[model samples]
Target: HKGQELVMADIPGLIAGAAEGVGIGDRFLGHIERCRVLLHLVDASLPGPVEQWRVVREELAAYGGGLENKPEILALSKVDLVTPQALAAKKRALEKASGQHIYTVSAATKQGVEPVLDKLMEIAGRAQAMKVESDKSWSPI
Candidate 1:
């Protein structure tokens, strides 16, 4: 928003063996190294949603390169497909497992999207600022 631009790359869903060049994981994971932030969207309609989230995290940790340390905005996608009770349970499980606030969103209904984007913008802005500060610090004194 504003005069600045923030681009979000839609990377493929990472599988278990992604860190070892399984499927297209290694290639895409490499691209993630240069990213300022990671927006991890979990498909709430799927079975074992928390496991899905963990798998991606495991792959990123295995990939190394400080990928595990990157700032992650965890979101629950496809919320429109699940019932209110299921959604609430998923939220609790995901939040407890990931230890982060989970943003529930449905692109089809456009529900809970703006708040997520606003949070993303704030995080990205701070990340960009830190990078610029770090870049300026790399000087021989």
Candidate 2:
């Protein structure tokens, strides 16, 4: 475990019309506005994992508020529930669609979680460094 501290919040699910007050609605979407990076956890055991990833992305983009532009990490969760072959296939598909690496993980079995956390820490550290540098550049007028 790294010494860096990271704060994370689990927002409600985003549906097709989340931006239009559908499902849990996008009221909480703004909570992520200040987040430097977003971790999108998609269920690998679900049918059409890629489609599910796209739906969430569309919701974020539609909601605007800079959420769409923030860096994102795609995590394929529930990997234990699916076969290795299936997991590999879905991970590849998601990576291709997202143009980023997909971290396969199983929360129940604690499988493949460390890599995801490690990556998150790395990204968060960089973001924090940038924020510090930006703050140092400001001065009272």
Candidate 3:
């Protein structure tokens, strides 16, 4: 990865039923309205991780404001706590569920994190370049 920097805002409250203002998740979601991309950090060790992913997807879809349409990076965190077989299983499940590349990372062991950062940098950089081009194309005349 290049030495590029990206700002990531962790919307710490997103959970099931957030769109209905069921919890503080709704409040924090507004903060991400301007973000170019979303990083969904799902816990890999959770039971039925796919179900959990679906619940968040439902909330985003319900929340509206084009959140559902944004490009997303899906990651399964805390892989160090799970066995290799379990990690592979969870990864496969998430990839099938999201139809996107799934990344596994563990902070404690520093495993598979660099790829995540590199992906983020590439995507966010592309998004920023597009935004700049879009701004230049605006013509009120």
Best by lDDT: 1
Over 4 Å off in model 2, which ranges? none
Which pairs in model 2 have colliding backbones?
none
How do the residues 43-91 of candidate 3 rate in per-residue lDDT, one tens digit apiece?
Answer: 9877777887888888888999988988889999989889999989999
Which 10 consecutive residues of model 3 have the lowest summed lDDT? 1-10
**lDDT for each of the candidates?**
0.93, 0.87, 0.86
Superposing every Cα of model 3 onto the true structure, what RMSD results?
1.4
Model 1, position 1, has a per-residue lDDT of 61
lDDT of 2 by residue, 1-141 (tens): 577688988876688989777876588887888788899999888999989989989999999897888888889999999998988899888888889888989899999889998988888889889999999999998
**Model 2 TM-score, all chains together:** 0.94
Residue 125 accuracy (lDDT) in model 3: 85
TM-score of each: 0.95, 0.94, 0.93
Model 1 residue runs over 4 Å out of place are 2-4
- In model 1, what lDDT does residue 57 have? 97
